[model samples]
Target: MDLDAYVAAHLAEWRRLDELSRRRRLSGPESDELVERYQQVATHLSVVRTSAPDATLVAYLSTLLARARNRATGARTGTWRGVQRFFVDRFPGALYRLRWWWVGTLAANVVVTGVMIAWLLGHPAVEQSLLSPAEVDQLVSHDFEDYYSEYAASHFAAQVWVNNAWVAALCIALGVLGLPVIWLLFQNVANLAIIGSIMIRHDHGAHFFGLILPHGLLELTAVFVAGGTGLKLFWSWVEPGELTRTQSLAREGRTAGTIALGLIAVLLVSGIIEAFVTPSPLPTWARVSIGLIAEAVFFAYVFVLGRSAFGRGQTGDLDAALLEDRVATQA
Candidate 1:
């Protein structure tokens, strides 16, 4: 093909694309026309690359393609499809990748809590020092158990959801500092340990477990995930591997943010269970079993569904091409 003739033939279309790209405001017809012209120029650019490979033409088309791409992307509106992808792929994928971090945190926290409970149970004097005799008596006799039934279920569920979500958010937001994540988790574990010790010493260990297990299992798991994700974000820069520290932190931060949103739902479920199931008239076994079942479902979701998504290279982040510095990451 004669290069001159080819250029001349499509010169009008190229000019049209340039004009449309430069326009400040577009009518409906002009917007449609711009898209059409953009597609045509892309095809023209492809043909020039293969058939002619002229440097000048190639450069011009490349610039035009980029402009068109930005315009097209900018014009597109957000959709529910994006939200669906977030939950179906991004959220689960992030959860799976960070499972080890959160799981480890969870294990350590549980051990710490159990140790504290045991120590307090065995040493009445130690427990007495932590709270006054009258305070301990009040908690053991009423405050602990009545915590579940003090408010209406719906109100309690909303309250619990917001409070737990806030804690999870704090773990993620303050995760960059490293020590704060640990401190926040320590606060949580301390509460559970104190409550458990008091209840068990009063011969109400069964009641404590009964009230907690229904919501605590899943609820606590969500908290663990948040702490784990936060700590991982902190480490991303500390041990950035092949990536630059900036790149590593950016990637992990995006994933951690996604985990935060996902945990909102998990916490909400636990809140519902705490409000409805924990305080229900159901037998202790039945209540605890419900909690176990809910926890099992979450595990299956992460290990099975989440693992699959992660294996497929889903990182629970926006595409790298969307970010300026992510075009060619090292690791």
Candidate 2:
């Protein structure tokens, strides 16, 4: 292609489109001309990109296209329909894409928690080092159970929700540091292990499981997802693949934002169970069943629904068509 001659031939039309796009009012013919020229300039952009690859030309066409598109579509806010699209397409798709990462995080936590429990159980001295006989007996006997009931259910739910959400937020907010995520996960697992070991050592293992399982399943899953997504964000900077570092981080960070919001709902469910369900007088089987059902629904939401959304080309990021000159950002 003779780039100079092509630009010479098309400059007048491009200017006309630019002028019509900039003008406050356009006659019907001019309006029609805007759309027609928009398409023509768009086609020229594609051809130039393939054949001549001029940065300035592509950017000009991209901006022109964007203005025309916005003018055509008009401005919109968070309408009900937009909110519905976000949850259905973006939120779940983000969670599903990051499933393997968080699943691995879940597995690692389980191993660490189990190991800590086994070690604590085996080493009686370790328990003694932390708590005296009287304290240990009190914990196993009443205090642990009482901790859940001492406050009103609603109050306790709010407290638990805030605390758990804070932990999840930390895992995400400090993801760029990477090590903070590991530390947060370790601290959470360590605390759980310590409490579990104390409960088991005093032969209240069954009671502990009965009390915890009703809420722990979904609660811990949310935490794992946060941590996993955070670590993935860190990895984005480390290994950006084909994207520039900034682009990769931008993409993953946006996705992480989706996970963060989705997990709020997930954590809310667990919080409700922890407050009302876990401490209920209902049968242990019934309580645990509720937890299991909630957990199953979450998994299905991410995998089944999220997979379908992803397959439909939902990447949980801003629409590429809405972006200006996406190709210009290429590394």
Candidate 3:
């Protein structure tokens, strides 16, 4: 196709469509013309994409067509219904679809933390290298417990929420590179191992588990979910399978965003547990049970609601109509 000649032939019509789309109001005949021009330009875009494959021209026509489409249909805004659908369908569906990724992450981190704890216990000298005897004594007896109750519950909850949310966000945001997500997860588990090992070695194992399990179970799960989602996003482009790299990335990226949003609520619940339940006068069994129940509820949300949504073909992606049209081409 002679790109210049083709553009010259359609340039006038494209300009006309642009004008109609830009207008605040259109007469009946002009509305009809706008619809007609929209279809024509859409076809032109397809042709240019398939034959000429000019990036600049394809972008121009795509933008022009989008404007015309919005003008023709009128714009829409989010409603309560949309928000309801997101939680009921999109969020759960995403969680279901990406279950293995995060679940594996959670399992692996647990194992690594356990091994690290065992190694540290086996090698007592390692502890002295990290902290002095005075600091260790302070941490084991006071600092560890005081950290939770030092602040008001509400203030601590907010602080925990913000900090955890930032960590989760970083895992997802830097997930595309792959290594960063792994590193983040490692840092998380390493800290746990270090603290857990120290507590156990110093005969504070019960206290440590009592304090940690109350909130750590759910909180760490949320973090693992973010890490797994990030790893999946990285893999999407690396091994796209049937879809083009761009399509796969876009699809996974959208799902990751949904997961990110959903995790806010998850992390909030954990934050509340940590701030209130962890530091409360409740017994260890009671507090740990509460954590267990929260973790169970999360799993049920994924296995029940998420599985059902996925069965109904919800992919946690944008609705098809809302996604931009892609020109099909052979690899």
Candidate 4:
């Protein structure tokens, strides 16, 4: 078909495509297809328009080509804006609504800790069964008191902080795989259970509390935050709310990522305390006081500070609309 004639005929469809592209609600494959189609049509039109013998005809074709290009550009820009809005504005709002999940996760942590304490009171042999020979040897020979004293003396707090922060980040990041987060939570809980059991078995459970509680509060809370991050992603896969499973997962994934990053910072501070301050042979009262303070700080951050720090506020049903738009656009 002649270039000018084809452009005239397909102008309406091209305009529609341009509008859709600008909206950027389309999937990657759909957007790519639309861009390809636009490029192909433009190329063909360009050839026909340039070959026109009449100057007026050539000028008219050029104008049409410019319009098509402008529309395509506008569509691309709109799509980017939509995506930014989804990430920066929409996702955090959705996370804020999921406050119940965070509370449940914290409750779960307390339950797990209580279970460990109960198991320690009930079973003594289970501790030995759970630990490998090497771990037992390390526990016995390490003189944790002296080791922690030396750690407090050394300026290695920053290094400990970085290492733990990385672990928390990894736990959250890998949680995106769904099952990995479950595995992480199980491993962490099991380790704590065994450690608590072993300490009590040795008649040092009270002593262990004195030694570990100072920092354990922060460290364990950070773990819970990491678990919460993983849980959010896993829930997205399991229950996508108003969105299809895939769409929900994608939307939740972005919010989960931000939560994971914040968890990392919490873990880092916890690690510094655990490494340098917790294991020392501090008096029971001192340890208890520190642990209580740490717990208070953690609660404050999770409940009061997090909302502002994360920029959470009422999104007024925007998330639902976004999901609907995504589904409709995909269809």
Of the candidates shown, which would achieve the greatest TM-score relative to the real structure?
Answer: 3
Q: lDDT for every model?
A: 0.87, 0.86, 0.91, 0.61
What is the TM-score of each predicted model, taking all chains together? 0.79, 0.80, 0.85, 0.60
* Model 3 local distance difference test score: 0.91
Q: How accurate is candidate 2 locally (lDDT)?
A: 0.86
Full candidate order by lDDT, most accurate first = 3, 1, 2, 4
Candidate 3, residue 196: the lDDT equals 93
> What's the number of clashes in each of the models?
0, 0, 0, 1
Question: What TM-score does structure 1 among the candidates reach?
Answer: 0.79
By TM-score, the better pick of 3 and 4 is 3
lDDT of 2 by residue, 74-133 (tens): 533246777787889988888888889999999999999999999989998988999999
Please report the TM-score between candidate 2 and the true structure: 0.80
Misplaced by over 4 Å in model 3 are 1-41, 52-60, 68-77, 327-331
Candidate 4 residue lDDT tens string, 113-232: 678878666875665576776776567446545556664444566666676677667666786676776677777777677666666666677766777678777776666666676677
Question: Residue 122 error for model 1, in Å?
Answer: 2.2
Off by over 4 Å in 2: 1-77, 325-331
**Candidate 1 at residue 263, lDDT?**
93
